[model samples]
Target chain A: MLQQYFGELETGLLSAIRGSDGLVNPRKLYSLEVARLGKRLCSGTSPVAWCGITAPFDLLHSMGVTSSFVEFVGALLAVTGVAGAFIDTADQAGYSSDGCSYHRAVMGAASQGLMPEPAFLVGATNPCSGGLAAIECLARHYSRPLTVLHIPQDESGGNVAYLAQQIRVLAGFVTAHTGLPLDRDRLREAIENTNRTRAAMCEMYALAQRVPSPATSKDLSNFGVVLPLFLGSEAAVELACAYRDEFARRCAASPTTKKRETFRLMWIQNRIQFRQDLEKLLENEYKAVIVVDELNDVTWDEIDPEEPFEGLARRSISIPFNGTMERRVEHLQKLAREYRIDGAVSPCNWGCRQGTGARGLIQAGLEEIGVPVLNLEVDCVDDRKYTEGQVRTRVEAFVEMLHGRSSPWN
Target chain B: MAVPPADFIGFACAYTPLPVIAAAGGAPYRVLPMTESPDQAGRMLHDNICPHVKRILDRAIDRDLPELRGMVFVNSCDAMRRLYDAWRRVDGAAPSVLIDLPPTADESAVAFFAGEIERLARTVESWCGRTIDRSKLSKAVEQHNVLCDRVDALTRRVEAGTLEGGWSRLQAALNLAATTPFDAALKHLDGLLGEAPADRRRASDPPIFLFGNVLPDPDAHALFEACGARIVGEDMCTGSRTFTRIDSDSTEDSCRLLAASLLRRPRCARTFDASDPGRMSQDVLDAVKRSGAKGAICHTVKFCDPYLVRLPLVREALQREGYPLLVLEGDCTLRSMGQHRTRIEAFAEMLR
Candidate 1:
């Protein structure tokens, strides 16, 4: 029943995005392509590989495997308001309530057979422990071949070389399972496509740092899903171009002169993708806007097509969570300074030890640097755990504190 | 606090290279799970991390670490990797290193692990301010080999129903051995060996194989005993898993021998060989068959991802082999033991 609801949601959204012609706007077209991919994943076709976002999708794409991140499915359920039941199912299936909601919801989905059996499964040691653990259970449940990428905590040369070798091994593993060798040209093309998307994302973020902040949080809520899942596709580049152009148009407009662009805030980790009025509440009630987030920026350098495997390996090892806590804190500080942000918020998503575990340190560091941070304890995917009244009160309090020091009213 | 001459290098997982630490003139200390409030660690790490990690960090945060030269962390799980981060943030006295362990033990994995061990050896040598020459490594291997042999021999006696107490006694003894120097561990085991066996055997007490995190207290085993069951064999991180003997004859390359033995040892949930998905479950089954056990118990710590994630599959595999499996979760507390006692006693009754 849950999968059917998602299936209908995808079909409806895809139809609207692809009405008659391709799309009236490129932005809708990108979303339509993404929805199409989501629908296909829900369709439970063979040759699909359920993977973590940190896994090398470029190589999977090169091997002709339909790679879908489990988190994406969890987010979809959250968006469609069907995640509560699945979260309950997972809770009943012995998952700890404190585990990340994203993983639990997907684990629940798998338990109910809402998720299809995959040809294989791939996971990595990055971002957090929850993803790998969830994938291991799913792999075991489905009896699929599981490949786990172990990224070193530190980004030493030896570690990079080690990961690079693993990426080479991953290609062989995928080939052995799928009987399709990764084409060097195909991987290079994927890398080049991803580089284009990264360039466009840079353009969008540059526009976003303006005084009025061109983009809304809702507009970019799906940014996390698109970049990690669709980076190697043409739609990803088109999506970036759409965001860049829309933000540029918004920044160059004339209606912002009379209104107050009161406060600019940065989101840490992932946004509350389920809330319909969250961005509006911040914008209208508090006059604060989430100009950027942790997931919005691309710290990855331009992928070198000449060395596709090494480039992907370098990108994999370079993830902020794969490194020290200081790296992530420093990156947030830089984002704060560069974006001219007043405050920051971390949702401290359940079941995510990597992001939530570093929250106190991050808050302390940001506070030391003259930026007050609110560490909100809320599950990102499961709204059953969300108390909107409490969240609003805390967020309102945080906004008032920011206003007391420097108000947009003045 | 001044560093002790025999500065023990604190390690978390069982798969960490203990023999190498010994080779580099440091005693390898396996941090066991204990029931601690973790108030200090909670101030640093979130309270929701696995209880085992929380307890380990609690010890560090409360300044409960013994005089140590340094710490060695393995990339075994996410919680452990974050433990290293939190340790660095606390600015502890001892320097730390993370050993990047591969998931599989293929040829490439062995080569990578050997290199990692050599790097660890270099780090330890520098810390102790002494060159661990080939002779020192060889001597350490020989000493460690004898300790392993002793542990294996003791474990065999217990499995064969010759020794008297529950497996918890063996677990506690191994815990002491893993945390001390070679000779001290042997002496402690010798003392246990000197105790004459009592005829405590019962045909109705169903023999069972046990596995998972460190069973720090004997209360768990005592509960099993009360439930009319005895652990014929254990695959615990602190039990038989630590007793595998390496090839002491290959003294020319101690690192290679250590890496090989680490692979050859009974596999843990955290250390996946990847060549076979059912290999770990099969090994546990083989151990169960070898010991003539009727059932198995996989006791795990709360939020322990490595063990918890693998439990369902291990349970399924074991059940398919006509072996009843019970998965008991706890935080290594007396209360958790009580909660598990009812379920354990019931399982034993069902087995009977």
Candidate 2:
């Protein structure tokens, strides 16, 4: 029953994406793909493995484990407009409602038995302790083994070396649990696929820097949301290629939209996933295009397939938000300059300490660089925590502030 | 003959290797959490950060730790890691070093942690301008162990109904022992040992185990006592859990032993032993059983992911053992003392 609901939604979305106009909205296509993937993962035909956002999906793909991420599932529920119910379910189950919406929604799903029982859970220490803690609960609830990646906070070579050792050990753990050893050649191929996807994303990002911004809010937002789930896979590469092709075609056919991108904005962290009309509101109502977001930036050095494990270890530690707040601040300033952003919006997602904890720092840093930032306090997944009107008002006020500035992006 | 202010090194978290700082000829002063809002630090940090961390940052921003030659921060959680970030930005803040404590303490983890401790040792040595001999480290470890044993002995007496200064005083003493220099802390413990025992025990005052994040403030305990309960034991980082014993053999390396002991110590939810899902909770249960407590209170700071996540298992285990458990959320402030008081008193009344 649970599988069919999402499967039917996926089918309907696919039809919507394939309407008579032909490849109308990339957002609908992305949503359709996400729903379809959710259906397949929840069907329980393949061995399911639950992981945090920072968990190495490349290795899991190589090992033939179907990795369903906690945050991705939370975002899926939010987009489907069922995350609030799950949040309430988690609250009833004694989870503090102020906890991260993504974790809480998934916990609610686990309580309702909506989530498929995974063969095992893999948790990493990169993002936040709260997320790891939530995953621990699911592991115990489902009586599944949980393999952990102890990603250190420091940027020292020793820390990378330590994580590399752990990644190797994790491979062994995946092997023991799945009864299949990791094929080195297959892992290398997966890493290569990720590199290809990264190259394509780079092209799309370059296209977004065009004065009018080739991509729409919906297009860039869904692309950012799904990037983490599809990394190191053929599907991810294909999706990236399709996105880049569409972006290039749009730039050539119509250099600018009718509304004119008056304000090029950079969104920090995750978007408000539950508000289905938020992207449209920003574009149609405010003439502000989210030209870039923190998640979309390629912060890590390119992964070396010859030394796959170490490269991945390096990549995980080098993520902008994973290390010191100073690193994230530096990257935000860099993105602001490169994307010609007139302003930035940090959605201070409640309960997400890893993402939202540095809001003040980011704001101060951006302000120092002459870029104003508006901090929007909202839950990324729980719609009940915020109203559309309040968010729209805030965005309007921010855009109004940007209109006063004489930036070239305007 | 007075000790200079620069002789001390301020440190946060119970997992920081205090003996190394002390052995390197520096006083390891504990930086306790403040209940006041950190307006100065607030400018640099988000409002949703842990209050305990906010207070720590506030202190740094206010130059409250002038006596420190430097400071050491443990990468214990997300909040602490960010605390390190904010602490570095404080004007006139002491030079800070972060110790990356691993989540698990398996052989490889211990080996890695030992290297980290050694790295910290070198940092401290540079600050104090003195090289620490292995013998000095051994001696410092010995003093720390003696202090832990003394604290443990007093605790055992209180549990056995032989010694009693009330739970409020005991918690305060533990908090002091946690922060004070080793020699001064030992003197304080000795004085606490000499205090007169209560003449009569209140049979109706239920003994409860208090465990969770740092609850260093004595007022929290006083509230529990006023509600007709005795905090016979604790599993808090700033409480008895810091009184971890080290048993280095004749030939064992002190750094390696310290690493091993820390891995085996009663830790918070942040550290997970893959082999034991209930290790952290069992630590509380063991303390409760030893103290003959009738109930347990797991107080956590809001958004304290480590403690909040392990709560369901702890609650379930305590319930299965026929002991009621109350989980309280605090923000390192007594602002909600009345509400907390009501819940605590009601729980005590239930136990009675």
Best by lDDT: 2
Name the runs in model 1 displaced over 4 angstroms: A1-30, A42-46, A91-98, A254-260, A406-410, B1-5, B35-38, B161-164, B248-253
Per-model TM values vs. the true structure = 0.91, 0.95
Residue-by-residue lDDT tens digits, candidate 1, A199-243 = 998999888877778766556765754576777877778878888
How well does candidate 2 reproduce the true complex, by DockQ? 0.65
| lDDT values for all models | 0.76, 0.79
Docking class of 1: acceptable
Candidate 1 local Cα displacement, residue B345, angstroms = 2.8
lDDT of 2 by residue, B196-287 (tens): 76543667688888888777777777787788877777777777767788766659777888888887675679888765554666767776
DockQ list for all candidates: 0.43, 0.65
lDDT of 1 by residue, B195-291 (tens): 7875666778788888887566766777778877777877776566666777765434678777777866667776665545545667777878887
Q: Report how large a share of the reference interface contacts model 2 reproduces.
A: 0.55
| Interface RMSD to the true structure, each candidate | 2.3, 1.5
